[model samples]
Target: MHMLSRPSVLRFDWRPTIRTLPEGQFVAAIGDVHGHDHLLAAMHDAIRRELDELGPRSAAVIHLGDLIDRGPRNREALVRARAGIDGASAITLRGNHEDRLLAYLGGSPAALGPWLDAGGEGMFTQMGLDPWRISPGEFRARFGEDLARWLEATPVMHRIGQLVFVHAGIDPALPLDRQDPHTLMWTRRAWIDSPGPYPEGVAVIHGHIPRRTVDFRDRHRIDLDSGVVNWGILSGLVFHGDRMRLLQVS
Candidate 1:
């Protein structure tokens, strides 16, 4: 059995204007998995233990995406994510890597090179194929087809009350409905640099820009990606009503 290191709690200290989840709901939002299946499994175990302690109530596990590429065990990581943790309904958001994957698999000639350049070739290498030799069709047949379909069908964002979950940050200038899909999967500087209370009461939870720790410095957004592939640690944030806690496994 895997053990989760003791969690660090952060009480919700937002100004009176920020909204929080409804009283009984609980949510665990995980950072980019990046094909770290062992860490994913351990994280799931920790979340199960958490829900058990919380007793019966509404709860969910949201994977912030980038479940594939740049690491070993991409397929296994997807399987574990699809299977979900025992106590929570799992929601997987589509990341930029997934976007590139779909485009490449759909026969977009322009998408292949960029995808490969961004560590996408690692998946093929794991499957015992020369990354350059395998065609997209062959790769899909061996590893993607069903997974691709699932990824295509997954939402880019999910909203639960005041909290909005996305793989990357949203454009601060536009309303949620009007924001472009590409921005949701890839935006960084613009979203991070914006100053002001965004959209009144809504807080965005995302994973894209890797940091040494979960970043809570921003008042309107929370960055959960701790660069798992390079950092050797995977992070998760738990939201129960107005309170939050950080859970991690290395």
Candidate 2:
């Protein structure tokens, strides 16, 4: 796969659909978008074609977050999501970027640089606002409702039969509902080192570390963050019962 620089975007072979679910297969966890609307569209098209081929009444789509930033159409992406296609099977999670925006809105200084450096500035710039000068109150007053609603529904972890879908990784030590947002949005090592029988029989399926491997340690948990903003395509896992398959976006 190739990721173009300048305005980074991923390029890779894309799959139109899944033919089999292997009995218990249900959810598809999508990686970060970082505002790459074109790639998102291609991904959506591929997903839809596949679903159309496979039937939407059977499987669900679980987007692992980082849905906005980097690319040019953050707002439009949200709008499309609001429209909800492929039979309303869309589920978007809150990535660290969204978390930072929430923190920025809630009045936090730590979020500024990271946000700006990671393309949050572009989104604000697109909206005709200077990322540096915006205040929390002002931010909330401006993007509050929509963002709040987006965050409110973003799931920390998705449990489908035995698979656990999360944006980042869970503390594994902390019980599911008890896990911290920080862990859910960033912790990597803890998730990798997580011993067995973690807080229910849930096999942790997650994203965050954008890599080529799709980085799976245990057969149960998988990471699909293929670094779309870095020019890597948004990747996903197609599960057939306990077996998992990879689908890349070009």
Candidate 3:
């Protein structure tokens, strides 16, 4: 997943198909929070204000994952996120970090080493779930049950009208229903650099690879991840009918 230091230049014009939902429907897709709970709350407040201003309408708030890791108060952030979406019409997708955490909790040898190396240990330590002090089975029984159930139930991709929300971009080569979860959560270089969008003129709204600003690289692909854990802004793209708006919190 090597992001181009300099994106390649292309000669042809790409007129992407513009998509829209019903007149009174709205959708908001948020980027990776990565344990930054304050930013998450701020973004939510902003969204609430926007929705209120738009008048009464059926709407959904979608969270692109990576909810924990590499920042302070991982457990608290998770709790906040869960509470935020608990009784609301919202969606939370599973990120690569969530997948790896599940693998570690299940004691998969292939995932344990890499998960620890990727800051899982620090997150567990901050949450007072010391992996060295408890067996994986005990940990699973004690701490992982509820969270794992929630994560396992989360969908890898969601479609609202013509827009698709996912943790990461899909491989355009595969049918939407047949997209692999692994690739949906972890793919980078190939998916991002691919030539076009999904079939049937559906646009992909995702977050995984971070950028300093919102990426409209391909007209049909919208990247909301601005890398909040790295001191970048946490952002959300609000879709209302045929228009889109950007909401952010630093």
Best by TM-score: 1
Winner on TM-score between 1 and 3 is: 1
Error of 1 at 35 (Å): 1.2
lDDT of 3 by residue, 47-133 (tens): 777677775368888888888777665666666666664223778888888888788677665676677776677576775777767
User: Which of candidates 1 and 2 is the stronger one according to TM-score?
Assistant: 1
Mind giving the per-residue lDDT tens digits that candidate 1 earns over 67-118? 9888787878888888897767989998988888788778666787898887
lDDT of prediction 3? 0.75
CA-lDDT, candidates in order: 0.80, 0.67, 0.75
How does each model score on TM-score?
A: 0.89, 0.78, 0.86
Best by lDDT: 1
Per-prediction RMSD in angstroms?
A: 4.0, 5.0, 7.4
Quote model 2's TM-score: 0.78
The best-first sequence of candidates by lDDT reads 1, 3, 2
lDDT string for model 2 (1-250, tens) is 4554432323334332222244644456678877776666666666665556545345777778777787777766655554445553677777787776666765777777777776777678667887667775676666657756666567666666666677888886778879887888888776767655677756676778777566554544667787776755777665544444566775
Clashing pairs in 3: none
TM-score between candidate 1 and the true structure: 0.89
Which pairs, if any, clash in model 2?
3-231, 9-231, 10-231, 12-250, 17-50, 34-69, 210-225
